[model samples]
Target: MTDEPNEIDGDLYEHHHIVVDAGQDLLRIDKFLMDRLPNVTRNKVQAGIKDGFVKVNGAEVKPNYKVHPMDEISVMLPEPPRDEELVPEDIPLDIVLEDDHLLIVNKPAGMVVHPAYQNWSGTLVNALAFHFQNLPEMKGNDGRPGLVHRIDKDTSGLLVIAKTERAMNGLAKQFFDHSIERTYYALVWGVPEEPSGTVYVNVGRSLKDRRVTMAFPDGDFGKHAVTHFELIEDLRYVSLLKCNLETGRTHQIRAHMRWIGHPLFNDTTYGGSEIVKGTVFTKYKQFVQNCFKMMPRQALHAKTLGFIHPVTKKKIFADSELPEDFSSVLEKWRHYIDHTD
Candidate 1:
């Protein structure tokens, strides 16, 4: 019997536990814990112990303390309430599916997921607040509500929002375990050399530019991220690809694809805005510029999402068609391919 203190925002909260087996050998508490937690650093565990957040048999214990069988361990940490309010807005939503516990939305490009600096209104959260009056209480970052996961503002597609605490925790766990199935469609600048492959690298915030992420191939920096991609259509100078995310980090698909030499079409943040392919003839340049004008954002969409139902344990899946801008751009590319040769 064991109760562990929950780790939240680098602070300990709700209780957790692990019962030692009868034949278990003595092990240091920190090392023992490091083996159990996923994606947690050893230094983090040691820090938790050093801060007296871990205890054995109702007594605070040191990191190096040896653990024996049947020791009841517990940690106590209180979670302070978040202090912010969401002002409901009347923005419209393109909801695809809704249940008593969850709602699936087909978010359009250019819509911010939640309120942020200079984006305090006209956000998805604001729209949701006005639509659902009986939302469950959640201490979200800066009072954002119901968001279990999110896609980038300019990259539109499907999103699943939790309506209750049970659903939120359930979906959050699925994301943490990387069990949620998500597929994205991207129109990139160049065709991948391989038909299908995976990019395994460390992705974290860029040191040179805080606004974007960078990949660390040698595992020297950042969090572990994996993206699997397959070519769907070859537009010669460009290609349409499907990307499956094994780990969802900020800009995982965008940054990883850029690292592999095929930045998403028109992704200005990673240098996709300028022409990277095709002829330099004035007519050709005008054609390319016209395409850019039609679709100004990155050509990436969250095409599909699948997860187990929080209430029924049944599988739930949602798919989204490309928005008009994305589809129109593809049609232009198809026409270009058909006639250019």
Candidate 2:
């Protein structure tokens, strides 16, 4: 509701101290500050915590430190001359479904879900902000509003966005309860050993590599994730698979598939090499290279989403078509299958 800039930047430094109230007890230090200081980033807050700029009870604490009621909280804020924040771009959107409470969009590849370091502009949130003009504010940070779920930056697909606080709360609850259905179409390097199967794995932050997520077992730092996949079509070397998300986690589909030894084609982040020599895809190597050259991201897309409407209580379903680059790759795969098989 407030048009406050989500981030502040510059050289003005100021130190402030405040007493925590009873209602704020057990709140994470960074999260509490993120709520109070609308313009500061979570990274900045964590940095301050690490540099001992944030203190509790006169002692320096980590960002995840929980604050109790009546504790004294102190922070040193650097006032950066604020630049124009997150200017909305005139990016065209594909609205698959829209109602007073929610909007389902076919998000194209190459668009970031929200703003972050080095990506403060040209995000889907910025475009929504510009187009909607009066989106309801979420309870969390000021950066993103009404964002109930997210899709990967390079993975194009259907994304459901809430328009009202009630709707947001309800939709978030549904997702947390695993009541919503999300299906994706992915083109991978090979067919699985089984025709259909479930990948039950724990996905957690990779301690060695922050950019990549890994699937591990119980008691690890990762959360439990389940993906049900069925083989839709096989192209000898590559296969088309339909994936259903039972529990959504960061890179759930990609990481789960990679963990099961079926890394997506051309997904370099998860150990997939480009179509090279000596594989069944030798004949279409040039075509694959051209498609990868033109495609900005991966060949994954959220194809369908189904949920009960928060207000209407009616079952709703939305679907998105594959982008042109993915379609072209599938076309080549079909051609290869026809000739070879």
Total backbone collisions for each predicted model: 2, 4
**Total clashes in model 1, counting residue pairs 3 or more apart in sequence or in different chains:** 2
Q: Model 1 clash pairs?
A: 3-16, 4-16
Worst 10 residues of 1 by lDDT: 75-84
Error of 1 at 263 (Å): 0.2
Candidate 2 stretches with Cα past 4 Å from truth are 1-86, 276-287
TM-score of each model, in listed order: 0.75, 0.78
lDDT: which candidate is best? 1
> Which candidate has the highest TM-score of all?
2
lDDT of 2 by residue, 1-341 (tens): 22223232244243556678878658888878775654566787899899876778768898889889888876655553245366777877789999899999998888889987667888999889877866666666455876888988889999998888878888888998999999999988788889899999999767555457898966466888999999999877778899999999989898998888788777878865566322555556766676567564667899999999998989999977888988887887788678764
Tens-digit per-residue lDDT, 195-252, candidate 1: 9999999999775554689999989989999999999999998899999999999999
- For model 2, give the 10-residue run with minimal summed lDDT: 1-10
lDDT of 1 at 331: 95
